[model samples]
Target: MSTFLSALAGGALIGTSAALLLILNGRIAGISGITAGAVMPLSRDTPWRWAFLAGLLLGPVLYRLAFGAWPVVQLDAPWSLVVLGGLLVGYGTRLGGGCTSGHGVCGLARLSPRSIAAVATFMAAAAGTVFLVRHGGW
Candidate 1:
């Protein structure tokens, strides 16, 4: 499949899963929230949280099984930089009330003003970071 088609399929799956979670479970499919809940789960929330996280972890495996090859991923950053970036993203998710999947996909679909602002902020910050990294020698 072409890159565009793959992206479209992935996006459709994400939206469908988010919608199903909302409709069937009356929950938001925010990765951070789901992960946190799985970590410190209420008795009632444990099963679904684990299931959601398990699916997330196994998605690539399933994809590889079906496609007969794992997706190619190239990481240019150092391990320390990657770790720092993950920590920063986790912190930002907590501070921003949601992650990109939550705000950009589900929240935006719901026409949330807060999600709009958050997504805009995220995009702007990302653009600024890329600019600084590429041009400012950082």
Candidate 2:
């Protein structure tokens, strides 16, 4: 499939999954929250959380199986920089009350004002960061 078609399909799948999680489990499909729950699992919720995480991990493998090759991931940053970036993102997620999948996808779908503001902030910050990295020699 073409890139646009693939992206559209992926987005549809994400939306469907989020909606299914909400309807079936009464839980938001926020990846960071799900991951955190899996890491420090509650007795009642651990099983579903682990299952959700497993599905996430399986996506790429499924893609590889279907496509005959794994997707290419080119990371230009050093390992230290990558780790630092991840840590920063985690800290930011905590400060922001949730991550992109939470605010941008699920929360926006629910028509939340807070999620709108959060998504706007995320977009602006990302734009600024890209601008700095590309133009400000960062």
Candidate 3:
């Protein structure tokens, strides 16, 4: 149906972007890694990192303008909780050595054991959290 077609198109777009970023930039399109590099860039690698980060920041705005609608994700949690969750994600990224895109997309495609483990752990934790919050026990 229309929804399935839309989802397929969206996924294909994501995969294309990921592939292009990896092949052209020789970098994984991991938001956390990109943000970190931009914020705490080394002496020689700041401009391109900043530009990449800016592209990421502006991408959704451009998408909304072109599509006339933005994806909606509503959370019941307060702003403080959301901020706390972000901090936790950043911390976990450092602990795991990479974010989801870096590990799941680029790394797993390259057959890295660390990336495989990281992605698996991420899936298990995410599934458990959703179960606890939605159905199991919260």
Candidate 4:
């Protein structure tokens, strides 16, 4: 498949899954929240959370099984930087009250003002970072 078609299909799957989660479970498909709940003391909801996470982990493997090759991932940065970036993203998710999937996908779909603001901030920050890295010699 072409890149655009693959991306579109991926996005459609994500949106459909998010909607299904909300409709069936009455829960936002926020990966960070799901992961935190899964790890922190067991509860009635833990099983589904674990299952959701397992599916996420399995997606690439499933793709490889069907397509005859694993998905490609290229990370230009050092391992240290990658680790630090992951930590920073985790912290930011907590501070921001949600991750992009929650705010950018689910919340925005619900027409939430807070999500609109959060998405705006996220986009501006991302754009600024890219600009700084590419043009401002960061």
Candidate 5:
């Protein structure tokens, strides 16, 4: 498949899954919230959270099994930097009320003003980070 087609398919799958989650479970498909709930239970919603997290972890492996090749992933940063980045992102998701999938996909689909603002902020921050990384010495 061409890159565009593959990306379109991936996006369609993501949107469909998010829609299905909302329709069937009456829950937003927020990965960060799901992960946190899985780690620390607040109610009786633990099982589905665990299942969702497991699917996320196993998606690539299943794809590899079906395709006979692992998906390509490129990591240019050091392990320490990667870990730090992940930690920062986790923190940011909590602070901002949702992750990209939640705000950018599900929330936006619901025509939420908060999600629009969050997405705009996320995009600006990402653009600035890329600029600083590529042009300015970090």
Candidate 6:
């Protein structure tokens, strides 16, 4: 019951943000695009994006301070690995023309064929990577 409630709350928050972004900006709240814009912003067009990204970056810090611990289990992976993974994900998002939220939620909801294919490919790649890491060890 607690877990379900927590998940429901999280989902509601995500849906609300998505709806708000669509309504306010006619844009999907896709992190990749948001981060890119912040890094290489359009002239005089950056505050909202920066604020959004800042919230995302600061949310966990606030959570840690508020709760004394994050809800999820922690991983001991190297910081370099995590940074590399983020970079790779950013690159992949560009290659795929959007990130998971854009393609998986917004695009699929809109019945986009390209998003369907892109998401399928992303899933397959993720599965394959996990398999290789866990079993193949190659």
TM-score of structure candidate 5:
0.94
lDDT of 5 at 100: 87
lDDT of each: 0.89, 0.89, 0.81, 0.88, 0.90, 0.83
Location of the lowest summed lDDT over 10 successive residues in candidate 1: 36-45
Residue-by-residue lDDT tens digits, candidate 5, 1-138:
999999999999999989888899998998888888889889988998998888888999988998899999988998988998999898999899898898999889989999999999999998999899889888
Report the lDDT tens digits of candidate 2 across residue range 1-138: 899999999899999999999999999999887887788766667889899989988999998999899988998988998998899888788678788899989989989999999999989998998799889987
Arranged by TM-score, best first: 5, 1, 2, 4, 3, 6
Winner by TM-score: 5
How does model 4 score by TM-score?
A: 0.91
Best by lDDT: 5
**How many angstroms is residue 53 displaced in model 6 relative to the true structure, after the best TM-score fit?**
0.9
- Estimate the lDDT of model 2: 0.89
Candidate 3: global Cα-lDDT? 0.81
The residue pairs that clash in candidate 2, if any, are none
The TM-score of candidate 2 is: 0.92
Of candidate 2, the 10-residue stretch with the lowest lDDT total is 36-45
Q: What lDDT is obtained when candidate 5 is compared to the true structure?
A: 0.90
Q: Report how far off residue 90 is in candidate 2 (Å).
A: 1.0
State residue 68's C-alpha deviation in candidate 5, in Å: 1.5
Alpha-carbon RMSD, each predicted model: 1.4, 1.4, 2.1, 1.6, 1.2, 2.6
The per-residue C-alpha lDDT of model 6 at residue 16 equals: 82
**TM-scores, one per candidate:** 0.93, 0.92, 0.83, 0.91, 0.94, 0.80
Off by over 4 Å in 2: none
Stronger candidate by TM-score (5 vs 6): 5
Please state the error at residue 108 of candidate 4 in Å. Answer: 1.0
